[model samples]
Target: MSKDRLISLDVFRGLTILFMTIVNNPGSWSTVYPPLLHSEWHGCTPTDLVFPFFIFIMGVAISFAMPTKSYDNTTFNKIVTRSLRMICLGIFFNFFGKIQLFGLEGIPLVIGRLLITAIVGYALMGNFNAKLKTYLAVSIFIIYLILAYSGIKSYEIVRLPGVLQRIGIVYFIASLLYLKTNQRTQLLVAVGILFGYWALLTLVPAPGFEITNLEKGTNLAAWVDSVLLKGHMWEVTKTWDPEGILSTIPAIAEGIIGVLIGQLLNNAKLIRSQKATQMLIAGIILIVLGQIWNIIFPINKALWTSSYVLYTTGLATLTLSVLYYCIDIADYKKGTKLFLIWGVNPMIVFFLSEIIPQAMVMISFPNPKIATGQINLLDYLYVAGVQPFFSNPMNASLVFALLYVSIWSVMLAYFYKKKMYFKV
Candidate 1:
């Protein structure tokens, strides 16, 4: 396979992150479009597709990075270090939004810390002068230590298993499997994982429950999460985490499926058109099989059900195939730059996206128009700037999300122009 970067893959990744930013950062959760909202329990929404699509893309990336090769310490260390970094960053995300520093508390503290974090992160992660980067990183670290030690308390229970944490874990396992096993073995392992996870959830009952089931907060996955994670579970449903331990088994399968597809795309013998057609056919088959399995398993994103893995991966494959045909095969590259920017620097952008909103919500001011008499920065923007012009609240909310996305797009476009892609 050629070492040149895949424009189609980059565009696909960018599109996923772009939509993710929009759906995740809606101006008002109450006013979000139904399609943007996650299903309350068992089903898929456009929003639900975002996380799986990312994981699948990560798998494809792994295929590109880890060629069929012999084992070596450097390769092993690279995989371990990268996985650890992502996992640590995920945990840091949980802590950063909550940790109060130097009595500042709330929005100001979060925003300030994040700004420092960005500077230090850029210095360390970006291509910069080694000495200067080291000095800047150390100085920032010492300053953060002083502030953190002073008055950083009220650190609430943080959800341990999150989107990035799961991504990290899945990447580590999938990368290893890719390195050690052949393509057929990888495919078998992927299929086996889905079947095994299905059997584990359906046939085995939790300690307290009388029978195996897939009910919310009471299923085997939830029970395992409660047993292991305990207090460190999702705040929305303290009983379980969507990215829980048991559920990650199927998530790994999702990554492996991506790896397989990546291998197909990377096959030099097959022309681009043939690769696209094959992926399209494979996507359709998986979608059909997923629907058939949905009768029993029921495609559930929170549970990361086997059917959900199949369905979402199928959709992701189909999406990537179309992009491959249009961008790589046909060389039709109009409007691809927009997503390419966000795609190249997805991690940093996603991290900022999460924290910015947290800080905005924390920083509130008096608003007499609302019954609460107080409104956060984000709500204030929507209420005063975006809401007045529209009759439908949902439309206003969507516009705010779009504006947020556009701002980030502009910022990322500059970074892309400067060739400053942050890798984590």
Candidate 2:
């Protein structure tokens, strides 16, 4: 096995997470710029690529993190443990600020704060234990389930599919494929999955929906989401979710592609130049293939269409290739420090980015516009600190997002300095 430390992987993962934080935490969703927001329905946008890029990064990171030649109980336990942690975290996030009962908003906020405090206390004590972790995980799930199901009559609360949960699922599948098969077989499997998903979505007529229709809720993916997930879809659209079950088939293909690329980069026989050239060639080929397929399938992030997978994965590959050349091959390391901080504590920063905003939103302050009403701390911070300065709402929103990312970066730097890294 190659002992080469791929600094580019960390930089790339950090870059993707940084963008994800920016896109997810804009000052005001209504005022966000065009490029920062996802596309209305079809076609690709910069924002749409962030999630898939992170998943691709996970696949690449797996190649480095996991044992390649062996499959055993230890490996299986590791996979299950990491995946459950992620899924539990996802459930916590999904219910963080959303679960309120009888119009009492403070209940969920209190629960969220208590959860954060417990985790912080545990970290400070440095007494992490498997039994304690198991109990905590089970307790969190039970609490979330109660809160989620409790408000079903008056609210739309249900067991929603979360970003972390989806990542955990996809990560497990991708990791297993990497462990069980060689790179060539993985590549073939990826192509076969994409082709199969394309056929399933395009050729088969969705029950009670239009034939070959790929519209918002009319597609087969959406139908499956509705039937299987029922009230557990995205809050924005109860009928369908962007990270629904069926769409994950093609999403797994993206991870497989990442694993294949990671394996190629891991080859000790290849020189840095050869590795970079191969990735560049592969990226170009995939992009061309994606574009050609887009004509027939229509690239849609919500659907996680085969074309969308190919195009986004291609872009991720090209991006990684550039970073690999500059950072690993050329030894240009100075500029990657900020990304490195974020990369090292990606999960920690991401969880904080989400939980902080949600917590802040729960604590209300005087609304400047409405004499009788109030706004959350997050909204107040954006309006008072950033929104008032710029005439353009979009500019203000973008600046707020940048400021949010910077705040997290500062916190992450402290952790980096302390050599405190949080994984999974």
Candidate 3:
């Protein structure tokens, strides 16, 4: 481990990414374990913590990244550029296979498009001339727009709000707050946002609804999404989006909480043990407060409720505190490398996790056992290769998910060995 870096943070991030990959890519979604699946309506599940954890981790990263720097045009540009790239990547993932090009729309088209975009994206991220990078960005945007509205598919209905998009926006806002405001101000803003969001949801009625409620589609957050994002909302529930506009207020608070924790962690005046102790105490307090608030607001992940933010941030803080004590403070270094590899280069691994499965599902081959006389590559691998050995469907699905994660782990290990970390 490097003297400059926190082994525990890397491990925590890697663990989150690993679990996120497994949660997202089950062999069969129908057979997933209850803990792996998100809660149906209100309440927190293990799966619900993954995203907020990542966001929290991002804030921690910002604390380490920005404190050494003097805020100037260059710093501002870097922040904006990184955030925009992440949001663009999120948009690209949402609309990956929707655009048709040269009479191609499946696996081949996806591969080609991904390759071209990767090249352009790489160039934009490279140490290229400012004018050239801007030109490349504009060119890609124009091409993407042309393809989106070319009438091949109804681009109007493509979902806009997504996980990465939310991350990007929150990161931008939180980064600015961290740069400009004092620690006291940051904490105050986080508290105000949380309480303000709670009040807005519980007190004010949505435009179309007469009552203030936390019901699925009738809630203020969902209603705001329905009006603002109309055709661009999530497909599963057109009337609402899990990553909606209003809900993001609480998400920002979540990020600010992360920033505050990061500030605590970054404080050199405090020793590792002190930091760990403080984090544990803070985590417990937040968790208790979240539960108390949940009595009225409810800890709903879909809504990104204020209570949900407090609860998950509490859990994250507790987890990190333990990791810090064991790994960083005590110097117990055994078995830390497994997660370190995945943690170091999370953005690329996550992006690959999304596109690889899509490409796999698009490629089909003959399979006599199926009604269609063919099956996609992913299903065939799961059905023929893994399912036959296990008696239980859920076990088989889980094994397949593990297998998928294991394959990526191997790839990430190689990347780690080569020191080839790709940042967004």
List the RMSD of every prediction in angstroms: 3.9, 3.1, 2.1
Q: Each prediction's Cα lDDT score?
A: 0.84, 0.81, 0.85
Candidate 2: stretches off by over 4 Å: 1-4, 98-156
Question: Model 2, range 1-424, lDDT digits (tens) per residue?
Answer: 1245588998898888998899999889998878888999998889999989988888887888874558887786667656666777776666555544445456455665657645643432233565555455556556656655665653355656877878988888998899889888998999899999999999987898557788998889998998988887787988888889999889899989988888888788999899999999989988999999999999999999999999998999999999999999899998899997888777776666777777777788679899999888889988889988999999999999899888888888899888887765
Q: Rate residue 341 of model 1 by lDDT.
A: 87
Whose TM-score is greatest here? 3
lDDT of 3 by residue, 1-424 (tens): 3467778899999999999999999989899999999999898889999999999999887898876647898788777767766776677776765655678766678677678557755854555665555555556556655655555455767777889889989999999999999999999999999999999999999887788999999889988898888877889989999999999889999899889998999998998889999999999999999999999989999999999999999999999999999999999979989999988889887776887888788788788696669888999999989999999999999999999999999999998898887776
- Root mean square deviation (Cα) for candidate 2: 3.1
Model 3 clash number:
0
Q: Predictions ranked by TM-score, top down? A: 3, 2, 1
Q: How close is candidate 1 to the true structure, as a TM-score?
A: 0.91
lDDT of 1 by residue, 149-228 (tens): 44534443666788988998999999999889989999999999999999999999987989999998889999999998
Overall local distance difference test of candidate 1: 0.84
Q: Which model, 1 or 2, shows the larger lDDT? A: 1
Worst 10 residues of 2 by lDDT: 120-129
Report the poorest 10 consecutive residues by lDDT, candidate 1: 147-156
Ranking, lDDT, top scorer first: 3, 1, 2
Model 1 ranges with Cα > 4 A deviation: 1-3, 68-70, 106-108, 119-153, 368-372
